[model samples]
Target chain A: MSRATELVLADYIVVALYFVLVLAIGTWFGKFTKSTADFFFAGRRFHWWVLAMSCVATLVGSYSFVQYSEVGFKYGFCAMTPYTNEWFVLPLFLFGWFPLMYYHRITSVPEYFHGRFNWQVRFVVTLILLVYLQGYVAVNLLTIGRIMKGVFGMPEVYGAALMALISGIYLHAGGQTSVLATDVFQGLLLLAAGIGVFLLGIAEVGGLAEFWAALPYHHRFPFARFNTPPYLHAVGNFWNDAMTATFAFYFINQGVLMRFLSARSVREGRKAMLFVVVVLMPVAAVAVSGAGWAGRAMVERGILPEDVDAGNIFVAVTGKVCGPGFQGLVLAAVVAALMSTLDTLITAVAAIGVNDVYRPVLPGRSDQHYLTVARIVAIVSAVLGISLIPVFQHYDTIYQALSDFLSTVAPPLAVPLALAMLWPRFHARAAIIAMVLGMILMITALNYPALVTPFAHGVDPSEGYSHMRSLFGLVTSLVIAVAATYLVPAAESAADRLTWFHIPRPRPARRRARHDIWHRRFRVQVVPGTDPRLHLHPETMKELDLQQGDVVYVCDARWWLGGLRSVHAVVGEPDDTLPRDTVRLSEEAVRRGYLKPRHRVILEYEEEPIDV
Target chain B: MGPWLPYVYVYGVGGCVFLASLVAGVRAGAIDLNRPADRRTLLALVAGLLLFATVHAIWIWAASQEPPVSDQAAVALTAETRA
Candidate 1:
């Protein structure tokens, strides 16, 4: 008798154990929350490192594993486009935009909209976010089911419900705490499994050089053919992928923007982002590309039948190469990844319901009631997600589904959010109309892509770039938003340029005879988001007794607080009071750049307080 | 699939347990579950390690069963029929 193989049974048991562990964790967190904030955003106490891992867990899902693996199996090394796109999103997140979030104090994208435009703008942005998020939620549910079917041989419907039930119960049980903390665990597991599978795959194929040699020429090199049609198609596809992903909403993503606000210091947030960029993002390359290589190995090994669907690529590879115990572990990792992303969407959707929907619909509810309602909303969303999975059963790829849904509102929102932040004239009416028009044009182009052939011109749509949606949406949103802002600028009388935080309590504002002078001194200096210990002068900050990154406006124009905006934070001089003892240095001294000593230069602004 | 991975996830699992205790309160109305959550955290981690190792073992066996990648003629023949 063949020895009873414990492999498959062990794998199932392991998957079951992983789920049970997740459930237990959720149950444990369910015991106590200090307050609603603890439930919602971990009391905003997560370190940057924690936040970074959570980000990875959120972005690197089972769908992505499958998406990349399929690409690898089909195209060999040419399957690097998505990996290339992942790299492109990093700099914008790391260097270009997120630092502003640490400086500009706001909660929720809507709050920024209110500051720049009005309540109308906030509503529009919220609606757009919901629309974009819904698609992601639906697709994730679909992925959960497909993963079950492929890896465990569960039926599609049962798999979908299983995911919905498991994710919904735990998500409702712990809220953001479960999502965040579990993400860290999930991210680590997924990363390690991915790297192991890839290394083994490369070895199986006799290393990278040997693998490349075995592949056909075009399969090994994707972009070698540079004809006009193909080249433009490639260029546009790359831009669409990067630009849409990188566009800052208000200033940054709410999930991550909150990390800075919760940061103990600006230094912590900076370090946290740096850690992610340096450590985690590189690891992500292994997951995406390694899965691809594993896919190729599976195909070449004849483990995958010729008739298998492209979507089944990862499932086949993982099943054929990894034994019972490892297969269960790998399957669990896939589920973890899928759940990691899916839970983020569910939490965000619940927040919308809690803050934006339930509270408004029934206002007098207690905080306890609000919390209960939030949990219910998550469960409801999961149910809806389950219902929607069947519709996408007809679609080809999960990642492609993600793109189609996201591409809808990205262009309109990207333009308005950026413009509203930098340009004061970006008014609400203009924003609303532009967003609506951009969406309409996008849908039209997606349906009748031929209408966009002048732009896509001889490019094939079936290759699935969906260029018409991205390009047309971009053109329409920019044109409409910019024109509306310029042509119909909001009434000067209607717009207010003050913030609640800046509107000081008058009693404190008038306390000292030197108040006017102090206000004038602090006029041009921005309240930096970074901690003085990290970004400001050593001598001056030690004595101030003020919190780092807090807005401390004195009367005189002092360069010590950094640039025109709080984001450009660095120390400029030693003291606002001591002109003689002052260390006069270059402008970079006040912001994050090199400072060379130069003759002192000063900026001018109003000394008298504007009517508050 | 080794011992190290479960170690990496320890912090995350512990944190999740601590967080989930609050969810139990919000849902069923009483949340003195932190004690049990802590216990579960350890159990979950141990279980996870075992699971990963098992999957790896299965993968090795499966790899042995599949035909070698060097069978070029068979691959070409399959490709022809699929097309």
Candidate 2:
């Protein structure tokens, strides 16, 4: 192993400052996390731009920087394959799955399983998903540890432990709210730091022209050779990364689901998804892979030793191009990548643990009790992640370990979930059989290896047939699902508001009104009742266009919160006894909208089209 | 393999996946072909794929035209080659 590169005092100071800034942001957001909704979904109030940034930060994990850089050095532009090819999965995600999950208010993937199929399906899916998420956390922790070993000479396990502690502390305090807020800051920092390193490296290699000219011609192509090499090839990546892995991330990953659910509306969520795939993802592709490309250019120009380890290329390149303090900034970006992804994963595991595992066994618990358990589960998740670091260390490259894990784990779940959402005929029994049989086939492929050869598509299988495993699993599961659905009687009823075809359409408003027009502020009062009614004084109702049974939106006066503190209620009989400027809301509406008692709120008629 | 092979492979394979999904959606009545909104979505999907293919083709063409170190020469200089 190569000796770690030591840093100067300036570097240490910069890193320390970054850590302090992250913790401070987490603390600030912790104040807003008051309920399970706040902890898991951030009160569903964030704008598309903020969520887009956070999603990019979460997507570009520490493993992305290191592994993509290593591949960028080895194969050049093909490092972008994973990020660029996600568009193929866009149709299913945007049209089919997004609406179903948003309108149904599905909290977790397993929750959807329970709603769509049966408890048995939910139980099976919950176990598989927990394993997938915990394994993801392990991969990320191991990657950051590798970076620490390269830069500071610290042992890998210690580095991972320290990161987990930092992330766990803030996650325990604020949950999803803290994760979203800190990720925005970390996102900007990592992007700026990555681009800065790239530009500086170009200057070091004489100029952009010289750098371009130094690279080998074959490396300039955007795709690798068709299928010659077992590890890095166009065909294998198209199947593994683009087809299977992309589906897993966008469709099934709990962290990504939570990010979408945190959006204020389905439209905002769609905007965030579009921005992530179209705009931010390509930029992130460059940000994560640029260092490796620069490192290769340096090697060609004889600026660095030719035999430098590919795994250490990112650190070596950053050290070569950046000055003392700036190197620390770039290092902090790596840490930022790790922490952003890690915190999201931790929160997701907590959601699944509480919602699927803990809540079912002990139902009807108080909200406070569930909230406390969620925090405890977050801490336990961090500890469990750190413990798995050793298991992932056996792979030659971090990229290999992650790809193997994703390809193996994603298909079984992805196949069933896609069918459950799209195919109305698919029932509970088919789903259960598919998952069980799929997992068994995956395990068989793992031990036998030759079973995957039929699906290899001419790619060599010597490198453990990592990518082909996804194809085998998906095909096997799909076949099983189809056969069982046909063979077994369609006993289960069609899931209402659960499948794609049955998503509730927005009814047209009774009367036309100006869009987003807000009325005067009124003091809010929570009337003692279970009725879904918002009672306003006669004069107040008249001013806001008086109509009984009309839907109205009541929101906090502070518009900057982006409807986080908001609720929708039906207008009731005008209350002549109440004060003219006060609105009376049911206790449930007040709680659902997170409205503060006695606080002034603005009311609007709900006549505009619903944009779901 | 030629430089254009990756593009062909990607679009050929990716196009199948995309089309298959659309068919499934239509069969399930999840995506109605008669609706204007759904039709627009289909058009956008086709356009997006074409846009990626066009941009990648142009990028590779531009990069191919540049005078760079040949693969043979670069491999000769390096002490070890991964591929």
- Clash pairs for candidate 2: none
TM-score on alpha carbons, each prediction: 0.65, 0.86
Error of 2 at A227 (Å): 1.6
Model 2 lDDT tens row, A1-612 = 123445778987998999999999987778777789889999776668878888888998767777898999999988988889987778898778876787777889999999988788889878878877888788888877877787677999998998898898889899998999899899998888888888888899999899888788878888887886888888888888898888999888999899888876665677788778778888888889998899999999999899998998988888788887897888788889889999999999999999999999999999889999999999999999888888777755654645555666688788989898877788888888888888788888988889989888888879878777888888999999999999987667747458777765543433323232454678987877677788988876766665887777677888766565777688889989999888898887787677897678877665423321
After superposition, the stretches of candidate 1 with alpha carbons farther than 4 Å from their true spots are: A1-7, A30-32, A84-105, A150-157, A218-233, A248-266, A297-311, A360-369, A387-403, A461-465, A491-612, B1-83
Return the lDDT, model 1, position A117.
67
The true-versus-predicted C-alpha distance at residue A409 of model 1, in Å, is: 1.4
Candidate 1 lDDT tens digits, A495-514 = 42322112212112222222
What's the lDDT for candidate 1?
A: 0.55
